[model samples]
Each structure stands twice: as structure tokens, then as C-alpha cells.
Target chain A: MYQIQTPYLLFLGDAPDQLAAKTARGINDWRPEKVVGQMSLENCKADLGLPELGLQEAYDKGARTLVLGTANRGGVISAVWMDVLKEALHIGYDIANGLHNKVNDIVDVAGLATQLDKNIYDVRHPTEQFPIGTGEKRSGKRLLPVGTDCSCGKMYTSLALEKEMLSRGMNATFRATGQTGILVSGSGASIDAVVADFMAGAVETIAPANEDPNHWDIIEGQGSLAHPSYSGVTMALIHGGQPDAMVLCHEPTRSHMRGLPHQKVPAIKEVLSLATTLAQIVNNDAKFIGICVNTSQMVARDIEGYLKKLEDEHGLPACDPYSQGTAKIVDMVS
Target chain B: MYQIQTPYLLFLGDAPDQLAAKTARGINDWRPEKVVGQMSLENCKADLGLPELGLQEAYDKGARTLVLGTANRGGVISAVWMDVLKEALHIGYDIANGLHNKVNDIVDVAGLATQLDKNIYDVRHPTEQFPIGTGEKRSGKRLLPVGTDCSCGKMYTSLALEKEMLSRGMNATFRATGQTGILVSGSGASIDAVVADFMAGAVETIAPANEDPNHWDIIEGQGSLAHPSYSGVTMALIHGGQPDAMVLCHEPTRSHMRGLPHQKVPAIKEVLSLATTLAQIVNNDAKFIGICVNTSQMVARDIEGYLKKLEDEHGLPACDPYSQGTAKIVDMVS
Candidate 1:
């Protein structure tokens, strides 16, 4: 709901490892043109391989926003990072934070930013009030990447689809629904952070009616319809977006759900079937166009065979979007 | 999560009609023993037929709380009613409010209540943090009354089931998931008020696993799974409650979802099949024991024939719980 200025200085605040700064990695990977340079503390291990820039240097480089893109344990913004944040605000950089701890809620940092008339956008929290979803059909085409479980490449698949569509000069826009996606795309709300009643409405807000009928809104998905803990959020996204086409995203190695050890990840078939059933509640023509797998844990030699097997069984395009690209899936819609 | 001390003075503040005071009517109808007396502003047109009592008199009559149970336009707490609320707090009464405007958010009222050491419960907002739902099966049984559309008698059916089960000396508790139900039962969370990710978790928190194997938590439902605006909330409730038994609640005369004139209600068969399928995702043995219809608009002569048709078609007990009671349906689970 908050407008974040572009040309960001990505900050990895003493991240213990590269994985800890995956948020930064995602933004740099997806939107390199938006990055002025990277900034980090001495102990930080992560690197985006950009020139290290100080607050003033980054500001001078035309960086309008300072993105705290690293995540630490507990997702809290450490007190040690305050000086850098304050300096960035003073140097005319608005802050965009994706961490659980909000930059807007920290008294000193917020007060200084307020005094300087700089905006602090907390990407994890939605600041806008959304209406209750009306279930009304909107104009334009939508494609949502639903998942077999949480964190199973839905965003990656969506982004890939958007890129492929754009590369072909097809009208497409990647709609972000989570913090990393929001940071990468520079817009959209964190759907999970919205009030329960307004989850669908938030989706509707983020991906509204478009004038172009051929335009595709590549809406990123969260959680999973098969996941007990997060199915509600998934359902909201499905109903709100009312996607014309859905792609099932899965992580092959995990036997259970993301956090719940007792819960098994549903089979790809089950997810696709369920996703179609639910999606069709709003859009009767909704159909599954592909299956996107996170085959990072799979043996390289087996990836092709596995994908082929899935494709054969489900009668849909199957691929690891990061590895194979979404060209095959995009071909169907384009 | 705030505990509202019982024996309430139901305040219907200048309600223009009985419908505006339906919340007060609900509390009185479901939990009459908790009502000490009724209070209203001078122009109030609704009555519960209970003795009128002033703040001090109600307190003397064993009322520990004043329930602002009437709803006006915009659900705002009228400025004219603040005096009575303040006086009630001064007379040692905690306030239970279901209005969209919160009692705790009103600085003067909140400040006075803090000074007086009395509680102000804003039932429409959830105050406690809920963990994400784990698909792990818990002990005890839960029964949910799902609807074909929002406000189609799910709450009434659930309450009826609880009352019938209790009268039959069965172990049952009404788990409220909305403000009206919360006020009636004096407990449970407003599921829709929870953060999107925690909707299921809120339901899990409200209908927790009980030690008694025979104990049935009759969880009140919200929204319809077929509803475009609110199916997300419904999905969360279904997954979180993991209900062992369910009842299909419908208002047959309605052609579309509540507040959405463009969206038609799903068929009764469609809703039942969908409810069962979704419910069985967590609890494999989950089932629909009956159908509860709100037949208030139907002619008396057609009621029996309509119910018979539904029962014959679905092979489940069908009844208007308000008119016929839930005895036949209760027998299945009891």
C-alpha cells in the first residue's frame, strides 16, 4: 500500500550466510536495474557482487530507497543496524524493509524519517484497508501459480512466466503477493499479513481489472491448497485472482509440509485437481496449464525424466522454471 | 481472548427496530440465564420483554457486564450512549461490545475503564496471537455448521445443535467464531478478524482438543465455501476445525450469495459434496450428519414437503432447527 521509490541500495545486515540474505538475492536476481549497489556490515557473509556503497555514496548514486533485504533469526531488525538506517534516512533515502520487524514501528528511526519527510515502507505489513471480496469478475486474463506446499517456487514460476511472456512481447505483469516478491517487483501487498476477512479482497486489490483482454497478470501465489496451515491464504488468492489459468508448483524432495512434520505433502495430482476445483468456483473456465517443480534437490540426470513423467501423467507442461525457463508453459497462454 | 464476566445488562441503544437489536435478541434467546435485565435509550423501539434496569439496579441484580448489543448504521458507538457506558463502568460493570467501533479504542471510555479497573471487550477484534495451523490431528470431536451463503443460519444451527446435544446430556460446547456467537456463548474468537495466515489457527485455538473423547465442540461457521468474497475464511475454518461432523445450513429462498447479487448460490448438493470433501482433507472420517434450513420465509404447508425432498435426495436429516429442533440431527452424532 506504501509507494517505495526505486533505485534501491540493498542492505545485508550482518547476515550469517548467503541464504540469510535470500531476500536481497531475489531482488538483485530479478530486478538488477533497480539496484544502485549493495551495502553490508563487516561480518556479513552475503554478497550480491555489487560495489559496496555507504549511505551518502548510495544516495549520490541515485538510490532513492534503502532496502533491508537480509533476514536474520527471529526476523527482527537488530539494534546494531540502527545507525546505518538513520544515516540512510538523513541522506535522503526512503527505507523499504521486508523483515518482520517494521521500520515504521521503530521510534527513533521512524521519528528521524518523519522529520526528514522520508517514507518507510514495511513490505511485510499491509498498510491499506481492503474491502471484503465481492467475487465480481474483472476484465483481463490472470495466471496464478498455486503450490503443492508453502515455499515451493510459486513466485519463481510466476516471475519466470512473466519474463518469458514479456520476452515474446506478450502483455504480462508479475503480481507480487509476499514480501520477497514485493521487494523484487516493487509493488503489491503481503497477502498473508492482511486481516482474514480481506485476504481475497487484497488479492483483488493487487490484481485489478485491466483494459487489455490479452494482457496476463502473472499473480504470485502463497502457501498451498493442500497445506493445512496455510490453505486459507491460498484459497483467498485463488478466489480473488480468479485466474484463467493455474500452474501447480511443487518441491519434490520434501515428504511433508513445510513446517508441519506430521503433515504429508499432497501428491501433484491431488494439488492440481484441488486447485482446479477451487479456482473454478470463481472462474468456471479456470484450468491447469502446467506443473512447475522445484527440482533443486533432484539429481541432474533425473530432472528431465521426472518432468516427462509428470507431463505424461497430468497432461500438462512440467518443468523447473528456474532450470528450464517457463517458455514451454508460456507457449500455451501466449 | 478477553474474558467477559457474565450476567449482562443488554443495552439496545435507541434501536429503530427489532432487527437492529438482533444481537441483544440473540444473547437473550440463546443464553437468557446470563441476562440480568435490559437497558435502552429513550427512543429505543426494540424490547426483550425483560425488566428495565438502571446501571446501579442491574449491578445490584447481579449484572457484571453491560453488553452494547444493538447495531446502528456503520456500527459506530453513538456519542449519546457514552454517558451510560461510563456510568455502567463506574457502577462496576465490564463492557462487552460487538460494534465495529471498539470500546477500548475510545480514549475517554478506555481511560475511565482502566481507572475503574473494569474490562472493555471489543469482540469483533482478536487480541491474541495464533500460531499457524498444523495438520496434526488432535483429540476430541468438532462439529461445524457450514452454509450455502454468508449469514444463512450457520450460527443458529450450531447453537441449536449445542442446545439439543446438551439437553440430551451429551458432552458439547458451542464454539463461537463471530461476534454475535461470542456474545451469546461468552467465549471464542472472531475468526474473520484474525490475520489471513492465522485464520485456521484462530479456529484451532477456539475449538481446541479436549480430554473427553465424547466431547463435541460445536464450532460456528462463517461465510460460504462457494462465496467469492469469503470462501477463504470458510476454507480456514474447515481446515482448522477438522470437524468430525458437519451440517449444511442454507436459506433456500436466496438466489445469490449475501451482498453479491451477481453471484448465485451453489446448489445444496454441490455445497454438501464440497463441504464433505474439504472436511475430510484433515479428518478422513468427517461427514455431514444433517441439513439445517432457515425456513422462515417458506409457507407452513410447504415446509415439510421441502424438507422431505432434501432428506430423500441427500439421505440426511433435514430440518428447520428453530421450528422443529435439532433432535433428529443430534441423534446421528450422539
Candidate 2:
């Protein structure tokens, strides 16, 4: 529910490797114009290939926010990074943090921000009190990507669809629901971090009625309906987004549900069927327009055959949103 | 995860009428031995028919907790009630509040409880970090009371089933998931108040695996799957509770979903079929053992006929759990 001000000064605070700065790289890649430059602490191993600037220099260069774009091993902002964060705040920059350890929880840093009347956006924790969803049909179109299990490529597919639609001159916006997605998109709530009663309401708030009837809101999905732990979030997204069209995302190499070895990944067919039924509760026209497979783990030669089989079996466009672009999938929805 | 210490001193703080004290009445009716006595401030109109007692007197009478069991217009703990709460804490009674306004939010009361080394449970707020549900089969038999809409008697059916099973010398426990149910049962988490990711995990924690293989955990269900506003909570309960048997609870005269004028109540057959399919994700043998109808709005003669029609249509025992008892339904699972 926190709206972050940008162009952002990305802080790659002593990241051990390039992977630790993946969130930073994502922001620079997606919204390059909104990114001012990168800042790195001494001993930082990661680089975003942008000019490095100090807090004052970045602020002078039109950076309004200091984004903690890199992750440490513990997902915490180390004590050594406090001085830089405070300096950024003093330079009239609002801070946007995507760490497990909240900037708002640190007494000194939070108090300083309060004294300066500056905003500190803790993206993982929603500060808004959301109402119960009314199930009222909103104007405009919605597309959601439902998955067969957690970490099976729902977010990737959603981003891909939004990119493809934009390239095709379609009115579409990416609605992020997770931490990395929120940082990448510059605005959106972390849906899974919300209170259980408000999950659907948060989705409704993020993807509200649009005045443009032809506009598409590509809402990012969360857990799978077959996931024992996270299906609640998935269901909330289905009901709240009220998607007119959906894309089933699956990982063919996943032998089990994420983080649970005892639980098997639900079959793609079952997830698609259940997702359609649930989504139709609010939107009678809800249907799966395509299947997005994460074939990163499969042999390169087998990828085409597997996708062909999926398209034949489900009677929908099937593609790997990454290696193969979502142009084919976008053709259906557009 | 806050365990309420009882025999409780029920606090009916200046309730306007008997209905305002419904939660107190429920607690007294379900757990009479746990009720030490009732306490009221000046001009309080509602009474639980228990002897009036002051803070010290109730403590001396073996009351270990002071339960704020009444509802005010705004669901807040009024300033006038603060003295009584503080006095109870001074007298060594832990506090259990079911108000929408949390007791822990009142600095004076919560601080004193902490200083005195006592507990003040804000029952509607969960303080524990619950793990994501594992979907692992637990060693026990469990029954869930699902519904066609919110507030359609899922809690009442669960209580009734627990009562019937216990009376029949069957090992049973009622797992509460809401405010009133928590007060009545004395030891259960408010599942809806939990973080979205932990909804199912909270259910699993409350109705955990038991050493007694024959033990029956009657988990109270939350919102209906067909109700667009809250089906996520329903999905969480289904996947988390993993009940072997489920009793469908519905209000026969209701034409629409609760709080939503535009949405119609789902049909019994549709709801049962959907519930069974979803519940099977965690519990392969999940089924509807019976139907619990709230026929309060129907005429006495029509109630029997309506129930007969339900039983004949669904091939399951049907009854008003309050009026006719859950004997037939329990017989199926027993």
C-alpha cells in the first residue's frame, strides 16, 4: 500500500555476488528511465553497470528514493549500511526497503526518518487497513497466471505478458504481489504478507476498476491451489483479481511442491480446471488462455516436444515465457 | 498461541441488552465449570445469572482469567472498563479479551500485565509465527463443519458435533477459529486474524496430530468457498484441517451470500462437490458425512420437510444441529 517515489538510487550494499543484486538488476532492466544510478558500499562484489554515485550526488541527479536493491545472506540490512541509509534520508530521499529486516523497525533509523518527515517504504509489510472484498465486478480486463506449485513461474509469466502487451501497443499494466515483483514494478503490495482476512481486499485495491475498458491488468499470482501451505493466497488472488483470462504456469521438472518433499506437485490439468472454476465465481467468462511452462530444467531438445504435448493436451497456447517470448500467448488475450 | 487461563470471571461491561452478552452466554453455556462468576459495571443491563462478584472475590473463587465477554457498539474496550481490568490484573487474574479493540493495545492494562508477569490475551490477534501447512497426514480422525456462506452456523455445528461425540464417549475436541468460538472453547487460535501465509498453518496447529488414533478433532470452518469475499480462508481450512469427514452447514432460507446482495448462495450439491474436491488435496478420503441446516427462519413443519429433501438429495443425514441434535451425522463418522 506504500507508494514509492522514483527515480531510485539503487543501493547494492556489499552484496557478495551478482545474484545478490538480482533485484537491482531487475529494476534497471525493466524501468531504466526511472533508475538514476547505482550505489555500492566498499567491498561490494555486485555491479549493475551504471555510474556509481554518493547520496548527495544521486539526489542532485534527480533520485528521490534510496532503494535497498540487494539482498544479504540473511536478508537483513547490516549495521554498516545504516550510515549510508541515514545519509540518504538526510539528503531528502525516501527509502524503499525490500529486506526481511525492516528499516521501520530500527529505532534510530526510523526515528530519524520520522523527524525528517520522510517516508520509509517497507514493501514486505502492508501498513494499510484493507476492507473485506465486495466481489463487485470492476470495469476493464484482468489476466492472472495460476501455477501448479510455488516458484513455478507465475511471476515470470505475468511480467512477460505485460511486456508483450505493452510492445503490441495494448493498454496493460503489471500488478506485482511479491517483494521482487514490487521492486521491479515500482508500485504494488506484497499480498502474501497481508492479514488473512484482507488478502483479497489488497488484490482488489492494487488492481482496481480502470476507466479504460480495454486496459488489461496483468495481476501476479501467488501460491498454487494444490499447495497445502499457500493455496489460501492463490485462492484470494483468484477471487480478488476476478480474471477474465488466466494462464496456467507449470514447472515440468518439479517432482514435489516447493519446500515440502512429501507433497507432490499437482498435475497441470487439475490446477487449470480448479483455477478456472474458482475464477468463474466472480467472472463468468473466466477461462485459461494459455500455458506457460518453465522448461529450464529440461533438455533443450525436449523443451519443444513437451510444450507441443501441453498445447495438444490442454488446447491452449503453451510456451516458455523466457526463452520463447509470450507473443503467441499474447495473441490470444489481445 | 496465547493459552487463556481459566476458570474465568466473565466481564459484561455495561452491556445494553442480553444480545450484547451473547459471547459471555456462549462461554457459560459451553463451559459452565470454567465460569467463576459474572462482573458488571454500573447500569449494565445484561446478566449471565451468575452471582455478582468483585475482582478480588472472583479471584478467591478460583477465577484465573477475566474474560471481556460483552460486545459494545464499536467493539472497543471503553475507558470506564479500564479500572476493572487493572483491578483484575492486580488481583492476579489473567485477561482474555474478545473485543475488536485489543487489550494489548491499551498501554496501561498491557504494561501492568507485563509488569505483574501475567497474560492478557487479545484473542482475535495471533502472536505466533506459524509455519506453512505441510499437508502431511496426521494420526487422528478430524471432522470440519463447512458452510454455504459466512455466519451460516459452522461454529454452532462444530460445537454440536463435539458435544454429541463427547456424550457418546468418543474422544473429541472442538477447535475454534473465530472470536466467540475461542472464548467458548477456551483454547484455539483465531484463524482469520492470522497472516495470509499462515492461515492453513494456524488450523494445523490448533487441530494437530494426536497420540490417540481414534481421537476426533472437530475443526470449526470459516467462510464459504462459493462466497467470493472469503473462499481463501475456506481453502486454507480444507487443506490445513485435512478432515476425513466434513458436515456442510447452510441456511436454507437465505437467498444470497452474506453481505453481498449480488451473489446468490451456492447450491448444496455444488458446494459439497467443490468442497470434497478441494479437501481431497490434503485428505484423499475427505467426504461430506452429513448436512447441518440452520432452519431458524423456516416454519416448524417446513423444517422437517426441507431437511428430508436435503437428505434424500445428498444421501447424507440432515438436521438442525441445535434443535434436532447431530446424532445422525455423528453416527456416520462414528
Candidate 3:
């Protein structure tokens, strides 16, 4: 009876093809037990089996490490990886962010020690051995501050509340508080109808234009830089002080005369560079550096490269639309 | 001023705290994003900046509609997916299995199609349309015949070789003539030492020891099972028919163990039960089903209730360990 030991590598991403190629190379070069496995957001539904079980299955199959590709948001794919990793490694968002940014800095011993926590290394490592802070403070028994902003102008504030309902396989109401502005040029009914339709779904809060601050934020802040349309108000939200993670409503396709020309690649570079600089300034205290942009702008490669480069260069942990899928999944579950 | 759009989501896992509260859930219930963006795996990798790009990246990114998972001797992952669905979405596999499986399924899709095919689709309508198969004939590019067995007791085959190699960013001297099996393994040593340490890396392919013939197959009529006591094998190569994609070796794990004294959970019931029953069949076409198991097995939930009672049980996916740490960084370059 030979016990299958978990491989030492884990690949996380939204690109399965890239993962496959990378895994093949790793197998040819390093040869772990298994090189690649696949999972998706749609698969996280109860009917399809949630992400937690998907990860466990991989581990049981003798995967010591795992790799996840960036998953799409609409399909709800990437969130699955977060569910599994949190369960398996006792990894939290802060830890995950840490690992995602400074994985190279984690030594084999640190990896093992982090896994063992206070049980094994408490007496030995002492000062350096405490569990790395996840930047989360436990409120009672709950993992406080469970939800995050969607960058789409949605915020997930309570995982416990949401998960409580979801465990029973029930859909929960999602709330979007604060205010963001939006300007509609269409007929009053058309604009009101559109707003009403958008607010019809499980959204708990939808402030009218008068109260929405997103417009002012975008107009006065970074959003103005991202888009310089001379007119039209849009929804916005304060992203817990981290402007990058803030969500902006209103379609990006809207023309912004006198606004910055839509040079997506360079813009993405600018955002990522900003994140890197912020990460450098904030050091390890940075939780997640998020940038919300219109999907129509730059190519996927440009965004991925910018994010990867940001992580590689500044050691800052940032989350964009690509990385958010998996991160969201973990946030929901943890 | 191109507005860059990125997809993002969040999920929760069955952490001790969450599980203790019986709050394990997924993201479906949360109203996160209504229409998320999608991109091809190639584009995603280009975004991530992976060198030596290949077809697998497309699948990993969920770009391909038809992706394959793991396979067994004389079995192809794509074929298996096809066996399950009249028209599979995307076929995903490691470089080795991709080549071997692609060859085995040569009659279905063209070799060039296997290499050049892009099965990108919207996750919302995964099976909306089937990709047109490439009609190229088998050009004897495969070094190993379909179902060819090795002396060590395993099957050999091939899949998308050129795409695989290009994806990994490797240049190699490949020959069409040989009775040799390519062993895929990696050592801590640099690339220069791979050929020198080749023999030392050869090891027997091990799965669970069972008498069920239907669940297993031999390559070239050679038994695929190895000795139960074998700890590790140097390497085993499945002959990929394509010149580009060839897998050197694969390591099996304890998760494949059959009839283990453990109760089945509802999440894994469908696949695990199928695997068990199929294992009993003397020549079932289903070779492998993706099974991902992580530390969540430690959860004290009512496994029976969860598997049987839940209308839709959440399950895990298989694991790929080689994507961890700097190795992932190396993958970007490769």
C-alpha cells in the first residue's frame, strides 16, 4: 500500500491552456505526481459540486500542490479555487495575497511551518513562528469583514450571512450601499426603466443619482483619469480607502470627450504601476490592490502581464478582474 | 483611453470555523456580476506573459469550449469527454496526454486542428455549438501506435506535440522511429542534467491494485498496473502521435485507491460511484474522472447527509502540484 504524497507545486490561474503548457513543462522538467487539473466557476454551483469539494478531490488524488487559472466573473468560475485553498491550507485572504505576491520569499521550511502553525514550531521558532496575520480580526466567531467590492460597483460585506443561506442552497439578497452618480441621456422612462431593471435582481441597495457618489468620485478622482467624458454621471463607491479596489458603474464604452484617450494597454500599465508603487509604499500591509476597468479596453494579455508584472516587480498583491474570480471564490467561502 | 474590462468573483470554503457553523457555501447565491467578460486561453496567457505559448493555455483559461482532463492507458481524455457528451465543449490534458489522446482521437479531429483548434465559448452557453473538426489525415507523425504497451506495464500514445512544445517554449530533437517510451520527470538539477539523469527517473506507473479489468487497460496488451510496493518510478512516456506534444511521465497517487474503508460523500457520489462501477467493468471506455480532494476531508460534516441529502452537493476538482512558487514564474518564461 503505497501512500501517494502530494506534489510540491500548485498552479493558480484563469488560463487552462497556459496552465496545461506550464504543467507539461514542469512535468518534463520537474515531474510532479500530476502536472495539471481543471476547474471552473460554473462548476461551483451545488448541482455541479462546489469548489471546496473540487479542491479536496484533487488533494485526495495525491496533489500536494495545486494550480488555478484565472476564471471569468460572469460564469462564477475562479471563486472555486479560493474555496478549496482556504479549506486545505488554512490559508486566508491576507495569506493568499502574501503567497500570490511573494511566493518566492516563502522558503520550504516556512511553508511547512506555516502549515503546522503553533502546534509544531511554537516553541522552536518562537518570534518568527506565529501564524502570519491575515489582516483579519475575528469578530466573535465569524471571520469579520468577509466580503469585498466587485469593482463592478458591487460590494460583498458578509460571507457568514451569505454562506449561511448558500449552505442550504438558497440564494441570498446582495446589498450595494453608498452612493454613485449616473447620467442617462435617454428618455426619462428609459433611464428609470434601466435603473429599475438593474435594481430588480437580488441587489439590496440602489441609490438614485442624487445620492450616488460614484459619479463625483470618477469625475474628481482616478475615474476621471480612466475616462474623461465631458458629461454623464456614473455610480461609484469608496473601496475601504483603497481606491484601486473601488467599483465604478456605467459602461466603459461610453465616449468621454476631452477625457483621456482609451489607450487600454498603457492605462493598464499605469494602474499596475500605481499598484506596484502603492505596494512598495504600503509594504506588506497592502491587502489587495484592485483596478476596475472596462473589459473592452486592452487585450487580456496586456492585463495579465501588467498584473503579473506588478506582483513580480513590486511584491505588492493586487487583484484585477482576472484574479478576482478565484479571490472572490475564496472570500465567499472563507 | 481604452476602458479595460476584467472579470472578478469571490467564494468561501469549509474552514473549521465556517464548517463548525455549518456555513460552507458557494458564490451562486450571491448576485456578484451579471455579464462577466470572457477571453481565450491564448489571450489570457499572453496577458500573463507565458513564454513558449501553446494550446493548453487556452483550455486552462476556460477559453476552449472542449477541454479534456486526465486519462488512463489506451484512454484519451478528449475521447472520454466525448463519450460522456455527444459534442464535448473543450478537451484539456497535460502535454503528454494531449498528444497521446489527440492521436487516439485522430479520426475525429485533424492533427492540425488539435494543435491549432481554439474552442473558445461563453460559459453561459457551454454546449451551444460544437467546433468543426479538422479533417487532416494521420500522417504517421505518432511515434507510438495507439494502445502501445511498455515493458514496465503501461500504455503509450500521443497528442498535440507541436502545440505542446511551443506552449512550453522548449526545443528538442524528436525522432519518429524508436521502441522507446518518453519519461517525463524533473529533478532539482538544471536542464543540462535531465538527459544524464534520465534512467534514474524511470519508475513504474502505479494506480490502485484491483482486479477489475473493465476499469483499466493495458497499452499494447501489457498490463498497466504496477507492484503495490513500488514507491516511485523513474519515468514512463506515452507515445504522443504529434511531433510537438509528448509527455515523459506521470505519477499516480493514493487517491486512486479503490475500496478504501471510507464512506462516499454526496458531492463525489456521482463520479466516485461511476469510477467504482466502471472499474468493475472489464472494458469500460471511461478511463479517468477528475477527482480533487484536499484537506477538507477533515471536516466533520455529516458526509452521508451531505452527499445524499443535499440537492446539489459541492465537490472538489483534481490537483496540479507543479504550479507552485517560482516554478510558476519559470512557467511564464518557458
Among these predictions, the greatest TM-score belongs to 1
Output the better candidate (1/2) by TM-score.
1
Candidate 1's DockQ? 0.83
Error of 1 at A26 (Å): 0.5
In the range A143-237, model 2's lDDT, one tens digit per residue, is 99999988888888998899899999999999999887888887888888889888899899999999999999999999899999999999999
**Where does candidate 2 clash, by residue pair?**
none
C-alpha lDDT values of all predictions? 0.90, 0.89, 0.23
Best by DockQ: 1
Report how far off residue A326 is in candidate 1 (Å). 0.8
How many Å off is the CA of B245 in candidate 2? 1.5
- Going through the candidates in order, their DockQ values are 0.83, 0.82, 0.01
* Candidate 1 accuracy as TM-score: 0.98
Candidates 2 and 3 compared by DockQ, better number? 2
Total clashing residue pairs per candidate? 0, 0, 153
* Worst 10-residue lDDT window, candidate 2 chain B: B71-80
Q: Candidate 2: where are CA atoms >4 Å away?
A: A51-60, B52-57
Better of 2 and 3 by lDDT: 2
lDDT of 1: 0.90
Q: Please, what are the lDDT tens digits per residue for candidate 3 over residues A47-101?
A: 1111332455655555454432232234333344445444545421111111112
True contacts kept of 2: 0.79
